[model samples]
Target: MAEKIKLACIIDDDPIFVFGTKKMMQYTGFCDTFLIFKNGKEALDHLSVILIEKKPIPDIIFLDINMPVMDGWQFLEEITKIDISETLKIFLVTSSETQEDRDKAKKFSAIKNYVVKPITLESLQELLPTI
Candidate 1:
C-alpha cells in the first residue's frame, strides 16, 4: 500500500466536487484525515488559527481558483504571509484549462502543480506519488 498522507485539505465551494474527491481519497487511502472548507476565507481563517497554535497543518491542499469570499489567488497571497511549515504542498485544482491560469500559477513558488478539475482517479493516483 502507498504511504498514507497524515492530513489533506480541500478548499472548494462545489459540494459535488468535494464529495467525489473525498470519496476517491478515501478509496485510494490518500490521507488519514481531511480538512474541508467551502471557500478560501474559511480555509485561511482556520489555517491561520492552526498556524498560531503551531498545530500540524495539512500535508497537501487541493485549492480551487474561483470561489466566493477570497479566491485561490488571494488565499495563496495570504498563506504566504503566515509562517507556515515548509512541508505544506498546495496544488491548484481548478476547471480552468487556459494557459494564462497555468502561467499565473507558476508565479507562486508555494504551488507544487496545477490540476484541471474534475479530478480523476488516475490523476489522483499520479498525484499521490508526487506528494
Candidate 2:
C-alpha cells in the first residue's frame, strides 16, 4: 500500500467539491488529516499562522483556480515568497483545461501537477505513489 499523507489541504469556495473530495480521500485512505478553506485568503491567513507557529504544515494542497478572494494564482505568488517545507506538494485542481493555464502553472515550481475537476478514485490512487 502507498504511504498515507500526514496532512492535506483543500482551498476552494465550492462546498460540494470540497465534500466530494474529502469523501474520496477518506475512501482511498489518502491522508490522516485535512484542512479545508473556502477561499485563498482564508487559507493564506491560517497557513501563515501555522507556519509561523511551526505547526504541522500540509504535505499536499489541492488548490482551486477561481475563487472570490485571493485566487489560486495570487495565493501561489504570495505563498512562494514565504519559507515553506520542501516536501510540500501543490496540485492545481480546477475545471479549466486551457493551455494558457497549464502554461502558467509551469512557472511555479511548487506546483506538482494540474488536476481537472471531479477528480476520480483512480486519479487519487495514482497520486499516492507521487506523494
Candidate 3:
C-alpha cells in the first residue's frame, strides 16, 4: 500500500464537488483524513485559529478559483502571510482553463499544481508520489 496522507483539505463552495472529491479520495485511499470549507473566508478563519493554536495543518489543500466572499486566489494570498509548514502543498482546483489563471497560480510557490474540475482518480494517483 502507498503511504497515506496525514490530512487533506478542500476549500470550495460547491457542495457537489466537495462531496464527490471526498468520496473519491476515500475510495482511492488518498488521504487519512479530510477538512472542508465552504469558501475562502471560512477556511481562512479556521486556518488562523489553527495556526495560532499551533495545531497541525492540512498537508494538502485543493482550492477553487470561483466563490463568494474571497476566492481561491485570495486564500493563497492570505496564506502567504500566515506561518504554514513548508511541506504543505496547495493545488488550484478550478474549472477555469485560461492561461492567465495558470500563470497567476505560478506566482505562489505553495501551489504545486493546477487541476481542472471533475478531478480524476488517475490524477490523484500521480499526485500522491510527489506529495
Candidate 4:
C-alpha cells in the first residue's frame, strides 16, 4: 500500500498564494488534508487547541513571514514551545528572498525549509520523498 500522504496546512496572508499552493499540491500528489489560515496567529492558536485535544499534528505546514497579526516569527516561537514538536514539520513560505529572512528562519531549527513564493512542481519535488 502507498504511504499516507497528507497535505497538512498552509498559513499565509495571501489568498492567491494559498490557491496556487493548493493547486501545486494537487498536481504533485504531495498532500491530502490541507488546513489554511490567514495568519500565523490563527494557525498557532487553532493548532494549540488541537494539540491539547490530542489531535494528530500536521505533517507539514507552509507559513508566511509577513502578516498583520502574530507574524511567522512570533508563531514559530510559540509552536516550538508546544509539546507536539516531533509530529510537525514547519516550512517558511515567504516572498522575501533576503538573506536576513533566511537567516531568521534558521534561528528556528524546527522549520523544515525556507520556500520562496509561488510554489512550483520542482520545489514540491524536493519535499515529497521526505513526506
Window of ten residues with lowest summed lDDT in model 3: 79-88
Candidate 2, 7-85: lDDT as tens digits: 8899999999998889988888877589999989999999888876778889899999999989999999888878855
After superposing candidate 4, which stretches have Cα over 4 Å from the reference?
1-4
Would you list the C-alpha lDDT of every candidate in the order shown?
0.90, 0.88, 0.86, 0.81
- Give the per-residue lDDT digits (tens) of candidate 3, residues 1-131: 56787889999999999988888788988775888999999999988888767898887899999999989989888878987554558988999999999999999998999999888888878776777
Provide TM-scores for the models: 0.94, 0.94, 0.93, 0.89
Over 4 Å off, model 2 = none
Which pairs clash in model 1? none
Model 2, position 105, has a per-residue lDDT of 98
Off by over 4 Å in 3: none
Best by lDDT: 1
lDDT of 4 by residue, 1-131 (tens): 22556657889989998888888777666666799999888998899998878877787888899987888888989988887635667888888999999988888877888888877877777765665
Candidate 2 scores a C-alpha RMSD against the true structure in Å of 1.2
Question: Which candidate do you rate higher for lDDT, 1 or 3?
Answer: 1
**Model 1: worst 10 consecutive residues (lDDT sum):** 79-88
Error of 3 at 38 (Å): 0.8
TM-score of 2: 0.94
